[model samples]
Target chain A: MSLDTAEVRAERAERSGSRAYLSLFKALGRGWIRDRSQIFFTILLPLMFMVLLASVFGSGDTAASRIVAVGDVAVLDGADPDAFTVVEAFDLDEALAMMRDGDADAAVVQDGATVRIYPSATNSTSGAIAEGKLSALVDDVNVEVLSAAAPGEPVLETEVEEADGGALRPIQYLAPGILAWGVAISGVFGAAGTIVDWKRDKLLRRLRLTPASVRTFLGAKVSVNLVVAVGQTAVFLAVAALGFGLQLSAWTWFAVPLVLLGTLAFLAIGVVIGGIAQTSPAAAGLSNLVTMPMAFVSGAFYPLALSPEWVQAISYLSPMRYLNEALQSVVVYGEPPSAVLPQIGFLAAFAAIVALVSWKTFKFDEL
Target chain B: MDAAIEVADLRKTYRGRRTGEIRAVDGVSFRVERGEFFGILGPNGAGKTTTLEIVEGLRKPDSGTVRLLGRSPWPHSPELTGRLGVQLQASAFFEFLTAREQIETFAELYGATKSRAAEMLDLVGLAEHANVRCEKLSGGQQQRLSIACALVGDPELVFLDEPTAALDPQARRNLWDLMRSINAEGRTVVLTTHYMEEAEALCDRVAIMDAGKIRAVGTPAGFVRDLDAPTKVTVAAGQLSGERVRELAAGETVNADETAVVFETRDPRGLLTALASDGALEGLSVRTANLEDVFLHVTGREWRG
Candidate 1:
């Protein structure tokens, strides 16, 4: 074809704004999928953490204490079945033998109105709990006998109830926090490392010569990261719910927008590091330096309230903390969407501020 | 119509911790007409790539102005970028994309169709390697893919910076053909290369640059013709006696060594006629001045590249 006609054809074929964005999104997504190491770090690593933690601290169920009741004590009949398992022993020697053999946590001997509890030294925690429950049962029996013989009723009674209506298991808290941590990692490391690689490879220079603007390029990248974040959330929630019996509430849907915001905040930080770092390795190192410590202070593994006061104070500064809290509120605590409005606001502000900083620091060329 | 590129008094300086301030491009000015194949020939560190980058809008010059297709390149005008294609000195591709995928991405960025991208791959003779991962391609193949990406948009102007550098002889020759085809389409081509032979072979007009300055600018033949250098004639050393050689010299410079007798002369025909009559033309060879000689004459230094 003639040069003039070729130019005219190219001009006619020129695609506008969204085409570049979609093409870049597809390219980046395909690249990320093909990189096994990246997939391992971003998705599999967090899922691994979830599995390990869930197994270690299984679904908030306290193990039932085993108690050998010598000669079938009357008090044993009133014991809560969920809290204790009572075993009938013919004599005191049999009950002591059961405790010695590790078959029972403690043995109860009833001699007249006085009852003695023999707690196992090997199983100290369960032994102590069994001893306490047996002594309380003996006191209740004594109160019942005295009340029948003397006054109309006992002076007071105590009732037990959870402060929060539903049991908050450790796995429930960990699931959302781990998911948020994964999102942070993929967002920050993915953006920073890829940008540095592109710069080193001179792809940034090539892109500048094209008609697509920087905004279009970065928008495509951020969109890919967001999609990956959503995928991460799905995997984490499904594993937590199906494998560990983590309860989900209607408010859990709010995690989608929160994840997007959190990814944006992390990606903004990544952009700043990518702009500053000279190489991909350096960018990775810097991202880890920022994200690992942030994960700790943000309470991905535990509650922020359990940290030291100074650490808690610093936690307020970490965007990860806000993301974790927002996700936990909606996913684990079953709080309404409005309950996490402040956290969402904080995350949005962090993303905006960091994005502005990255924009100011960003450079298309090393020089 | 406006010239393809117009650069005036362009200057850029880089400050290094140890080197302090280095002038990368100093008071450089040149113009490339539409549909012209222009070459910037220089040695390493001569600022040819820097000048090309500034004109391509990849960098900001500290001072002076560049009018690319009648528009300022600075501040990154999208309209100007759409009409220009650039192949950088270094070839960089997206991480794991195939050759075709890489060019297709560039086509999308430039708003060209995938068919055009494929056409460009065919144009560069990479159609067979379309499915090959870019990292797996040979150095020459990678360079060709970069060129394909540059032209996928069918730009009116194209900039190539050392496109054939460090390639094998066959690859270099093949690339020369590709470059010729690019220019044959009537696209204004601006090329920077350190190889004098490359500049001589492909460029319509050549600008010789040294130490961040344009030493001279003209057609390759024009520069050599204007050099006013004498041709060298050489033959076996012992073919004739010293006395006879002096007689045949006729006031021209003559130097004799153990292997050959050399003559520097303005009139090669006269010298050849004399050698033929003397019957000392055995193993004789004549050498004409070329772009390398022009570079040495203009720069006052040996060609280091």
Candidate 2:
């Protein structure tokens, strides 16, 4: 079709725009790859820390074995000479408390005639196995005494009670933490820091000279970052489930979205931290400082129930905690985002606060 | 035709936190005619830049009115900016963009961006490095490229601040050729520099500015003529008498020492006849006074500073 002069001019303008956009992309892509080490620290490193650390620190292997401190050595009074050292002597309540505190993986709660193992009902086999070992230890000591005094002397052995399955697997524990981290990273790194860096580079100044609205620029960045964050979160969830046999329930549609929303919440926190910082170094540091304590206290690596009461109280204020709790409720507890809407509300509030502060405090030159 | 630039009673005070008010430009006033190669000659910190900024629309004066092409340049009218060009003394560009790309980007700013990007590149003798990044260009090339940027919009008036202030002799000569060619096209050029020789050679008319105001303004010949007339002077050492040198100087005593002497007078023939009588007018030189002498006569100092 033949075009008018105005149409021809418009076409040329469009072509020029396309060329400019391509040039911008090429430079940006090269710069991103060249600064790979920085990207590692800024993007991949924190998430790796979240996943690997949760795996290493949250395993339940040792949780199946009991370590009950023998108090007063009263039961070993008669067999002290012949028995093995460090035999896990059993006391019912103490053993139960040991297993509950996770200090003792399994506990031999011994009475006069019967021995009881109080592991979580989750791992009943571990309790039985632990009891068998304790009974064998007791019989072995008696056999030693009898064999020493009279050759071929017989010993009596009896069965005992066992508790349930041990606490939980590593992947099972880590799913929520990873989910929380993904949310926080999305909000902070994707939203606040990206905008702040652009502003600092005077890229914002160049863009401002154009006719594009501020809202449009911001919307484009957020949209890109959010889309990428979703993909990243999906990849991590898939990996954890497939590799570690983590029972990630795609059960309810709300579960993953809940986790994702939690991720977005913390991402907002990251955005604020990163955006508020004038330089990249400052942004990275501020985000990290907020992330580390949030990770530790908010049950990203451990249960909040395990932390100090005061720490648990502080976790209520932490957006990471809300994100973690919110995700854990969905991914582990089989709850929906609406069921934990209070938590979602808190996390959303945190994100809103951070975003507002970032918007206000952020400047192109810090001037 | 409207005057290219008009500034009346322009003043600019830089308010300092600790040092209080420092007046950078003080009630400076001047008019630049269309097609006039007006020169602003002054030493550093003489408010030359401040006055230029007011005209260029980069700055706002405290109290006076500044009209560029009959419009206020304070808010920087695009109509003015599009038709006017500037070569800032310390302008810089991205090092990564090739010289060609740099020119292309600037050219795209205007609608009828003369496809002369390459022609201009060839004009500046940078055709070979049209694809070379700005960082790789030599200092002179960079400055010329800056001049090329000003030339891009086909502006009617140009503001050149020390265009050749730091260039070497050859580069300065090359730039002078370009400036003459541009001036030959009848475009008004307002330039600031400390080089008196350059002003004398290139400027049609100059304002010898000092202390934030024009001390004198005229064509090169008019300025020199304004100096007291000394159409001729003679100095001879072969057999010159000390009395003869003093006698020739009559009014103010022309320079006299043991070996040589100097003379200045309203009438050269009578003075020469007097010296001839003493047989001491062996080597005499008669010539019109130049700008340097006129400036020294007017400003009472070396032109270099």
Candidate 3:
């Protein structure tokens, strides 16, 4: 075909748009990889958080808690010894001191028929976990006392049940949430910081001078970050499987689309912050304010069901919560694709709305 | 040939944090002919950059219209922007990308080839620094890289805002020649700068802006000639005392200082003849008045701010 032909010109025009998209994506990826700080924060920091959280919450092989018992051994007669290592203290003061000094996870004090557990609130996560275990043990001891009193009078029969899909280890439960958290970090912080930097450097002004639309530029950014998110998921899952013997359900493949949608949602959040902020530092602060709270309330570090009812209600507003729930249902519960459709739909709508808002607020010029 | 750019009654105002309203570009208008080298010359904050930006479609005028290639630039930015090249007044590119990569990206944005980008790099004398990251380049090199990006599209019209503001003397001269060559190839070049010499050296016509308005518009020599200022003659480390000074030139202005003796005269031949007869022609230099002298004549020597 002649170079001046209409067909050739149209082809060239089409190719150039895609070429610009690809070129921008590749350049952004290369720049991100070359900057060690960006890599550490976007990719490595999330993994580090995962590792730290898993080590703390998923190390189920270790002793559950260390309990200082301040009474005779009769009160703990029916409690499981393997669950918690019990220490004997002659007085309640000594037991409370042990708990305060960090020598023990909790102090169990008994006065006649009144039994109380003291777990320091300073270390909230461990304290809550230990207090829960202690309360369950105390209930077990009460059941034993009642059983002894009424041998065959049919005390209420209780049975323990797990979730629909067989039991899952803490690591298995946390892997998907942590992966979603990584995607959120890359989406929210990475996209916002990049936009803010571009605005500050007049790069947006330069781009505005070109024929490329704002959609194309932002599309390239989101595409590159999605690639990073996929790689992040794969690496984290691989590490989990290799180190902790994680067993993913057959429906685990559904997490890919879920993660991508989650990435878009988080990236929209970043775009909004970047558009609203005038400076890079302000963008950073705003992104943290957004993602940090969502990280906690959205079931990234813990299960949403474990939080209070009001907090769980609020988690519905966090895109991360939908991502975590959908990913966990696939990777841990072995739920079918239909099970996550609502979550996927919500995430898609959330991403679209936020992206629209961001676009409306974004300024191509300094004004 | 039709005009490449036509901006009429262009105005833009901004709200300052403490200064209230700032009329960045107040009722500025100019026309750039096809393939001509045009310039907007002014001091800092004189709204030259704002005018260029409005013409380039990077900004919108409050009440005026801009036409590039006979189409409105504002409402149809993408359509016009595809055929226009723009280099901003500030450094703007991917910080981590090499100069070559940055240029290639810009070329692709305009549906051009990487070979074209490389050619632009060569044209700007930046081929040697193609692989160097933008942040690592010297200020002059970065400025040149921006120029290469602007030209990578082989656009019919290119807008350069302070393209040589950060360059060294040699680089600035080289860029001027490069711009001239580009214009010679049937491309209109519009530039803005505070340096009058840059405008005089490169522009076919220049518009002098001050306080957000165009004060005068003409050819470089025309601007000087329009002022009707006299030719300047200086005698370095020499003086013509009163007796000889009166005979030097009858109706000319004379100013003498410790370092030099100066004369502004419309009659150079008569003054030269008198000086030669008096044997007081040592260390003499004569030149026509330039744009700077014209500017001082029109705007006065007071600092703009």
Docking quality (DockQ) of candidate 2: 0.09
lDDT of 1 at A251: 88
CA lDDT of each prediction against the hidden true structure: 0.87, 0.65, 0.81
In candidate 2, position B237 carries an lDDT of: 71
* lDDT of predicted model 3: 0.81
Per-residue alpha-carbon lDDT of candidate 2 for residues A1-367, written as tens digits (9 for 90 to 100): 7656977767765665554444444433333344455346435754586567665665434433544644443333443332222335445576566566545545544465444444434345555555555566667666776889997666566565542233456666677676666566545654446655565533443332222223433444454445555555666666667766666544434545655555556656665666567777777678768777777778877777778998898888887787676666666656555678898788677667866775677543331
C-alpha displacement of B260 in model 2, angstroms?
A: 6.2
What TM-score does model 3 achieve against the real structure? 0.86
Better of 2 and 3 by TM-score: 3
Per-residue lDDT, model 1, residue B17, is 100
| lDDT string, candidate 3, A73-157, tens digits | 4566667777777889999889878767777877777777777888855555566777888787777777877899989877676
Off by over 4 Å in 3: A1-12, A59-64, A67-81, A84-96, A106-164, A211-215, B15-21, B74-83, B236-242, B249-251, B257-260, B272-288, B300-305
Tens digits of lDDT, candidate 2, B1-305:
77988888888888879989878788788888999899988777778877887777566678899888888865533446667767777644432577887666555543335476766777778889897877678889988887786777677888888989778999999999998877788889998988878888899888777666666778987888777668657566756656655656778547756655667677778887877787765666765677767667667776665
Task: Kindly list the per-residue Cα lDDT of model 1 for residues A1-367, writing each as its tens digit.
Answer: 3455766656643557678888988888888788898889877899899888776656224767798888757677788898788889899888878777788999887777667788988767668877877787788887887888888664577887765546777787888888888999998998888788877678877887898887787788788888988888888898889988889888888889999999999999998998988887799899999999998898987778888998899999999998998888888778998999999899999999999998887775572
TM-score of chain A of 2: 0.62
Q: Which consecutive 10 residues in model 2 chain A have the weakest lDDT in total?
A: A205-214
CAPRI band for model 3: medium
